[model samples]
Target: AALIVCVLVLELIVRQFPAFVIELTVWGLHKEIENKEVNVADKEAEAKHQQHLARFCRK
Candidate 1:
């Protein structure tokens, strides 16, 4: 009886382990995408500031 119980527990953990890993992977991907967007926005703001400064100096 104890052996059977152990087998059941092992099976459950094996089946659920992949699901946990997949969730973590997807969450990590989302965080990475969010960071990438932030970087892009910062670059765009810097570019716009540089353009404005150029135009100001031209005047």
Candidate 2:
């Protein structure tokens, strides 16, 4: 009986593990995308500033 219970519990954990891993992966991807967007925005702002500096220097 104990062995049967152990097997059932193991099977349950095995079934759940993949879903847990997938959730973690998706969550990580979302965070990475958010960070990438922030970095892109910062780069755009930096480029604009550089353009302004260039225009000022030309005058």
Q: State the lDDT at 7 in candidate 1.
A: 98
Error of 2 at 46 (Å): 1.2
Please write out the lDDT profile of model 1 over residues 10-58, one tens digit for every residue.
9887899899789889999999999999999999999999999999999
* Model 2 C-alpha lDDT per residue in residues 1-59, reported as the tens digit of each score: 99999999998878998997898899999999999999999999999999999999999
lDDT per model vs. reference: 0.95, 0.96
Q: Tell me the lDDT of candidate 1.
A: 0.95
Q: After superposition, how far is residue 53 of candidate 2 from its true place, in Å?
A: 1.0
Instruction: Identify the candidate with maximal TM-score.
Output: 1
What local lDDT score does residue 14 receive in model 1, on the 0 to 100 scale? 83
- TM-scores of the candidates in the order shown: 0.55, 0.53
- Root-mean-square deviation (CA) per prediction: 7.2, 7.0
